[model samples]
Target chain A: MNIFFFHLMPYGDLDLSYTDKYDSAWVTLPNTYFDRSKGTAIYDRYIGELSLADELGFDGICVNEHHQTAYGLMPAPNLIAGALTRTTKKAKIAILGRALPLVNNPVAIAEEFAMLDQMSGGRIITGFVRGIGSEYFASGIDPTLSHARYYEAHELILRAWTEPGPFRYHGRHYSFDYVNIWPRPVQLPHPPVWIPSQGSIETIEWCAAKERKYTYLQTFSPIELAQKNFDAYRACAEKAGYKAQASQLGWAIPTYVAETDEIARRELQPHIEAFFNKFLRFPIEMRMPPGYSSIASTKMLIERKYAVRASQQTIDTLGDLGMCIYGSAKTVREKLLHHQKEMGIGNLIAMLQIATQPAEQTEKSMRLFAAEVAPYLRANASTAVAAE
Target chain B: MADNVTTETVDVRGLKLKVQQAGSGETILFLHGAGGSNWTGLLDRLATKYRVLLPEHPGFGRSQIPDWMMSVGDLALFYLDFMTASKLDNVHLAGHSLGGWLTAEIAIRNTTKLRSVSLLAPAGIAVEEAPFGDVFLWNHEQSTRAQFHDQALAEKRLTVAPDLDIALQNKSAVARLAWNPRFSNPQLPFWLHRIDKPTLLLWGREDRVIPYACHVPYKNGIAQAQMETIDLCGHAIHNEKPAEAAAVIEKFLSGVKA
Candidate 1:
């Protein structure tokens, strides 16, 4: 399986004790707590880590956007991806991505992505996301228009990339008279499009359609939920008159490796707990803002994922639930290989740096994962080979 | 109490609308707020004197929204078309909250059909110091409670929240219309001068949603406007202090008739 490094670049210096006074680590959380010097250091160090991942031979490096949150520092993941272009070579730069619905100008994004594609020699993997509902609150874009806007923006971006511009592009949500982009894209017919999602069925169906056939990367969801969604994607592909390829499916989860299982657990425990319990202490309304999704989609989400709030889950239960992976390299590889075989995921997006994981320790873990776990998985790319 | 309240579905711009109407005098088209139109005490008391016509705004109650009706601006235009098509003459226009905002929008556009206008805690103008409450951020219990001065009454109302589908439809419509720039049109204050008809502004002294502080702009904008403040009341002045609010409106409407 292809290994990619995913970075949230969270506020690593967060005084986790903020949970005592504040309701969440997201939008409403006061920005007074953000330390400037610490922020600058972590940002530089995080980019260094992405470059390190490239040197370590990961196939791709990913960054994503979130607004008004201490959770992920990159409100503009494109900037980080751009920085990667100068610092790293060979590895694909995946901006996993810009919130399509929140932006009024899709053409600007088209130009940026095109420029990045050119800069990286066409190594850009365009990932479009409808951004989480909490983002709608931050952007002040109508939540009711989210789904419609996302689709329209996606169409507009695709058009701007492929078609010769100064073209009149009118969308329900956005209207543009001049649609010409200068750089266009280094990749033909536009760069490869990937979708990083939180297991929305509508997303799966749309991405799995024959015309699109975009890679669908399930992000930070439980493995069972990922499997169910992947199966749904396959079902959609079948309806669209083709079987979905393993290459079109991927999984992103926070992972840690050490000398032994116990040592790995001990090392990751505080950071993982703080990550889930404190940083992800979000309100239900903010998470699923009204009109953010269709009634069916919201109902499905509530039914499938509502029982346990992110704050409620302990580290052990989270591992049991297949949300995060942590162990010795051998254990990590075996579990990942098993899931890859079972779910037929050809890509594994490992988040090596987590909430408050020290720089040295993160490097050590990444090095171990790169040296030991990555080679085994790369050699045994096809699960069918291992099965025999 | 509901015996005189008659219901009918009317077609406008190829969309269906359920109108709850009663009494028989000067037509008072009472538009409801973001809360959706219901058989409330304000309508009933007013219905006893003037003919109170309460139609669900498109996308609320029994009204199925047309794809074209996206924002409050569209809603305002739709109402103007409905009024013109129905051939209503010298009618008194009254509205609450978002509906109140719509009432002003309609009047400012063309007041030839309107004899007078009444706005209860209207949500059209933005005041700098006392910004309107962020209703979008408030959840069911918190938002509902914030609307009334009496927390007990608010809780009681919550137990009987309207049908799930209609309530959701209403909430969605409100969110779509007033989500950004949040419940107030930026240019509404500038256009308030166009209201040539007699205007009545009823505000709650303790309206947590749209505070009493908003009255300054509304009063200053409409030259021939009568303003009143209901003590110990909130945004839902029509429901919270229905009789008192109705009495003030009744007195104003009577003087307008004179």
Candidate 2:
């Protein structure tokens, strides 16, 4: 399996004691708690870790975008991707991704991604997202128009990358008299597209139809949920008349490895708990605004009580539910392999760095995993491919 | 309270809408707010004096929402077609909250067709000083509580669990129409002068949802409009003190010039 290093780049110096004072570390969280000097140090350390991952022969390094949230500080993943292009070598700079609907001009995204692709020598994978519901409030975009805007923006960006410039375009959400983007993407027909979703069927079908890679995000949910979603994606691909290859499906989850299972758990549990319980503690109304989700998904969410469970989840329960993977190298490898087999995911995006995790400890975990875990997983994946 | 209310489906522009009607005198076209249509005590009270017509706005309660019905203006036109389809003329228009906004829009466009207009906590006028409360952001309990003056009434109103399908349908419809400008049309204050008919602005003094102070803009904008505030009431004025709200509406409608 292809192993990628995912960094959330959270503000690592948060006063954990004051977490109870706010409803969440998201949209409504007071910025007075954020320390600038510590933030600069964290950013430097986070970038250093990503660079280290590239140097250690990881297949890819991932960055994502979130707004007005301490969950992940990178509001513009493209900037980080641009920076990574010059600093890192041989690793795919996976911007997973830019929130399409939040942006007013999709061509600008097309131009920027194309520039990154060229600069990185075709090592960029562009991931288009509708963004989480809170982003709509942050960017002041109507949540109801999110789906329409996202699809339209995706189409506009794709056309800007592929179609010859100076073409007039008219869409419901966007109307540009002149559609032209300079420095079109180096990869033929644009750079490879990846979609990181929590299993919205519409998104699954859309991605499968377009033949883009579908990355299942383990957003503090049980393994069964991810498996069910993966099954749905595969079914969607089948209905679209294509057998989904292992490479077409991916799983993104938090993972940490140490010399022993106890050490890994001890090192990871508090941070994981803080990340989910504190950082991701947005209320249901804030997280999924009115009309943000489809009727079916909304009903499903209510029935499943997904938000309630996510908010109340404890560290022990999350580990038991396989929402997070942490242990010694052998244990981590086995657990990851189990997920790969169970979920049929070919790519594994490992979030090695998380909330309030010390930079040195995070790097050590990453180094240990790289040395002892990645080779076995890579070998197994190639063998499985060769056998096929 | 009227007991013989009949519900029927009306088709306009190839979309189906559920309409409730009762009594049989001069027509009183009733428009419901964002909360969806209901056969309330106020409607029953109004029915005693005149015919009450309550058509569920497209995208609310048993109405087939046309894909193109994306704005309150579309709804205003739909209601005009509704008036045409129903073959009614010189009807008195009464609207509450979102419905009030729609009523104002209709009156602005077709002042002659509407004999008089009654707006209860109307939501179209943008008030910079007293912005409307965000009911969409509140939980069911918070929203329900905000709608009434008495906690017991709020509890009673919320006893029935909201059906997910209906709630989602109503929310999506509301979001499509009002999420951006946030329950108010910016140009509405400019156009309010076109509502030439006698207008009544009723507000609940204790309204937590739409601020009571918004009554001034409506009263100022409409030439023949008069304002009244019901004490110990909330945004859902009719639901809170049905008799008082209904009495005010009845008195206003009684004063409509022939």
Candidate 3:
């Protein structure tokens, strides 16, 4: 099993008192709270931390995009990935990913990724996202056209990379006179594409199609929900006349590990509490908006994720549901190994640096996860591990 | 006020449009707000003297969304096609909020069949002075209560019916039309002058959704428009002050006919 370090790079110095003042830590949270002096230093520290993850022997490092919100500082992940390439040597750099429909120019993305792929010496895994609904409010892209725009952008980007360029590429949402991207990618037929989602059914089906069997990464969802979605992906693959590989399924989970289970929970309590309560307090409208997801996906998400606000959830409840995992190396490893066997997850995207977790604490968790938990999982990858 | 209220599907542009109508006399083609409710008390009051017609906009309640229907401009064009298909002449075009925005768009484009246009708490252009009360940011309940000035009435309405699923579906339709511009067309003020038909602009003094500040553009732009404001009312003027709103609109329509 390959372990990847995923960082949201949130405002670590966030004044939790904003919980009393704002609707959420997202779009509505006043920017007055973003401590200016600590800004560049945080980015400097975070990039250094990701580079350390590469040094610490993690197989890959992941970054993603979000806008006008403290939930993620990276409005542009490609730049961060570009910076990481100069700092880190061997780890796969996954911009997991750029919001496909938000950009007016998919060709620019083709260029950017191709350039990043070249910079990273062919070790780039591109992840395409429809972006969150809040981004539509931020970017003024029509939510109703999200599905149409996303699929079109996906095809256009693919064609830009594969098809010989200086060609005319035209779609309903985007049109380009020249399809040529200058920095041709190092990886032939384009770099590997991974899709990280909350398991939108359409996304699952799309990822499983025979022509494009991208690795489907389920992020920040309950174990049951993740299992159901992965099963659906396999079913989709079977219907498409192919059996999905174990490597095609992945789970991106925020995890913390320590010497003992009690110590781990105690140390992670406040950070985990603030992460769910403050950082993830997405009001129904702000999160889903209107026509952002299909009604079916909306209904499914509401039932699983949104029905219970993160403010009401705690470390215990989140852990029980498999939304978060924090414990001793033994407990964490056993749970991961059990779930890996139970649901064919060949890739483990561990988010060791949780929200508001201090720099020192994060470093401790990362080292422990790397030194203890990851090695056990790697050693027992294909074994039929029994649940404790 | 009338016992003859009836509903039938009108085939417009290959989609069955659900329409509710009552009474006789001159035709009042009433378009609903973003809320997309059926036959309100305001319409019932108007129905006593004029034939009140309410066609559910596509993607609204009980109305199947046509594949090509995308924006308020498209909906405005659909209503124009609806009028021609229904063979209505000398029609009084009336609409509320999103519907009011559509009324302005339709009249500006072509007013040959319109005798007068009534826009209540219209939302077609932004008011720089006061920000649009962003319902997209507020929770369903907060946004719902923000719609009315009378808390008791708002509470009563919530107590009776608070279906977020249905409300969300309607909002989805609104997002398709109004989300991009944040509920206002940049060109609306420029074209408001073309709506030369006898025009009425009614606003609620305490409206939080569109704000009373927004009425300025409509009042100043439409040369024939006479603006009126109702006290103790919010954006949903019909829900909060149906009788008062109906009385003002009734008097205006009578003056237009005279």
lDDT of 1 by residue, A344-372 (tens): 88789999998889998899999999999
lDDT of 2 at A155: 88
Candidate 1: residue A211 lDDT (0-100): 91
Tens digits of lDDT, candidate 2, A1-388: 7889998888777777666687777777888888876776777788899999999889999999999988888998888888899889999999988899998888899999999999999999888889998887688787888998999999899889889988988999888999988788899877988888877777777777745545544444578878887788778877888777777777888888988999988888889988887787776777778779977877777676655664467668888888899999999988887778777677888999978888778988899889988998887765554212
Docking quality category of candidate 3 according to DockQ thresholds: medium
Candidate 2 to truth, TM? 0.95
lDDT of 1 by residue, B72-191 (tens): 888888888888777788999999999999999898888989999999999988788888887766767888899999898998998884565666677777888888888888888888
Which residue ranges in model 3 land beyond 4 Å of their true spot? A300-311, A383-388
* Candidates 2 and 3, the one with greater DockQ: 3
Best of the two (1, 2) by TM-score: 1
Give Cα-based local distance difference scores for all models. Answer: 0.87, 0.84, 0.88
How close is each model in CA RMSD to the real structure? Answer: 2.0, 2.2, 2.2
Model 2 has an lDDT value of 0.84
The lDDT, on a scale of 0 to 1, for candidate 3 is 0.88
Quote the positional error of residue B198 for candidate 1 in Å.
Answer: 0.9
- Candidate 2 docking band: medium
Q: Weakest 10 consecutive residues, lDDT, candidate 1 chain B?
A: B60-69
Q: Candidate 2, after superposition: displacement of residue B237 in Å?
A: 0.2
> Residue by residue across A89-187, what tens digits does model 3's lDDT show?
999999999999998888888899999999999999999999998888789888888888989999998988888877997777898787888978989
**iRMS values in order, in angstroms?**
1.7, 1.3, 1.4
